[model samples]
Target: MRGLVWDGSELALVDDLLHRPPGPGEVVVEIATAGLCHSDLNPIDGKITQEVPVVLGHEAVGRIVERGPGVRLPIGTRVVLSVFRPCGACEHCRAGRRTACRRTAEPAATPFSRDGLPVQQFVRTGAFAERTVVSQSQAIPIPEELPDAEAAMLGCATVTAFGAVEERARVRRGETVLVVGAGGIGLNVVLAARAAGAGRIIVCDRNPRKHDIAVACGATDFFVTPEASDVAKACLDTVPDGADAAFECVGRADLLNATIASLGWGGRAVIVGLPSADTELSLRIRSLFHDKALLGCRMGSVDPRTALPELARRALAGEFSLTPLVTRVAPPSEAGDLIADLRRGELERGFFDLRGV
Candidate 1:
């Protein structure tokens, strides 16, 4: 099978990429489409450390072509991929801590190879290929009505946004919410806050071009500035008491600090962005005195196998916006190019249409 593989130094298309069949509690999915995200660049560009010769995608939607032992889903069932594979027996999984799953953090096994050598995985998933294997828990079935391109995003961006608002912040009705960085993920955060009935949703970003799109997604106001201090001030002024919840979707230390400062008394700032490895933010320690909380978000704290179906129902009901998030679709040949686009902030959300391959 053909796949985009990244060695330690460069990315290249390899036609001999191979994946083994489903083992116990695993499923093999034929890729329909896979979404390209900013985090996908982490390994290839050394933004994050990862094993080399790995397939480079996680956010995707595909149909199950085979199932391993104990798997119940029938073949041909369409599903959204969840990159995190929790070892159900571990302490974290038993407590429903999906994101903290032990297996996802530390690699356990590789399912792919080329030239009889292992091809490492990114985020416990390697969906950038024609077919890939994943734990059964990582597969979430979706309704037939969900578009393939849109459903691909459910694996990461959508789930992460939903998790950030609902799990990390517990945003409730009539509260003021602020979302920093109105990119694909940030826009979803705005929409999620709106669905939760936030009285006012303020978005901050350097690009004024994204203001309209952010507003369309649920931003009641926007702060268009590159300076974090200026953006925070705008957000604070928009909500006199301070924002009830703020999401830092830009993975920069300065923006994260700004998001934390934008909070009102007892406000929560959830870091939803993936920052560089070993990166740390310097913040005002005294800020916590207002009962303000700073928290990190992972996959929106969502259990895809359980939560995806309901989210899909809400999406199908027009409660969540997906179309606006999906800006383009490209072939796998452009996978590397899309990664470059993601780094350049030129794409909202895009997918690799692997069905043609």
Candidate 2:
């Protein structure tokens, strides 16, 4: 089998990779499409450290081609692979806090190898490869009618956005929302906020080119600002008192601080982006005194078993369209350049059509 392997130094296509057969309660999926996410760039740029010789990619849709003992999902079933696979018996999972499950922090099993050396899976679902093994619980079934590229995004970006707006921020109808960054996750935050019946949705990004799509995704206003410090002012210029909720999707300390500052009294600011391991925040302590909250969101605080299916249903019903969010689709061999394009803000969202691999 062939897979995109990050070997501690660079990402390369290794055609000689070996795919380990599924063990008990596991399944092997033939990846159809995989979304290129900003999170995938963290390991490559040293923002996040990971074990080398690992397959990278967490957002993907695929079909089950092989199943191990105890697997109940039928072969040929289409599924959206989830990033979190919480152990049901863990204390957090028992308390309905699956994202905080202790097992999620443990090292995931490596089901791929090169030259007999085990290759770890990034975020436990290495969907960048032609095929990858995942625990049965991590493979959430989606309707076959959903497009592969769109379904792939539901695994991460869409879910994360919905989780931030609906679960973390608890945005209410007719409330105002401010989103920083207009990239993949940021745009989805706009869409999710709109679906939640937000009255005025404002989006801020450095890229003026993203304005059209941001508006299409339900932003009532878009602001292009070169400085992160100007975000709060721009947002307040429109809302006066400030927005009801703010989401920072760019993962920069400055942007997060600006997002917090853009919230009104009793407003909530949700951190939807993943910052570097060394990133720190500088804040005015008094800014959060007015019943304001600074919240941290992990995987949109969602349970994929229910969330993915509901998101799929909404998409199929035309409540929101995912096709507009996808800006490019290419083969896996172009993954490197595409990732760089994403890093440079040259693309809104890109995908890898792994079916040809």
Model 1 lDDT vs. the true structure?
Answer: 0.86
Tens digit per residue, CA lDDT, model 1, 57-156:
9899999999999999999999999877777888878887777786766665889999999998778788888999988888889999999888888778
Instruction: Give the Å error, residue 66, model 2.
Output: 0.8
Top-scoring candidate (lDDT): 2
| Model 2 residue 293 lDDT score | 96
| Whole-model alpha-carbon lDDT for candidate 2 | 0.91
Which residues of candidate 1, in runs, are more than 4 Å off?
none
What TM-score would you give candidate 2 relative to the actual structure? Answer: 0.98
Clashes of each: 1, 0
Q: Candidate 2's residue-wise lDDT over 1-357, tens digit each?
A: 888999888889889888888999999999999999988887888888788878999999999999999999999999999978788787778877888886875777789888888898998998899999999989999999999999999989999999999999999999999999999999999999999999999999999988999999999999998999889999999999999999999889999989998999999999988889888998899999999999999889988888999999999999999999888999889987898899888787899999868
* lDDT, model 2, position 119: 90
Residue range with the least summed lDDT across 10 consecutive positions in model 2: 100-109
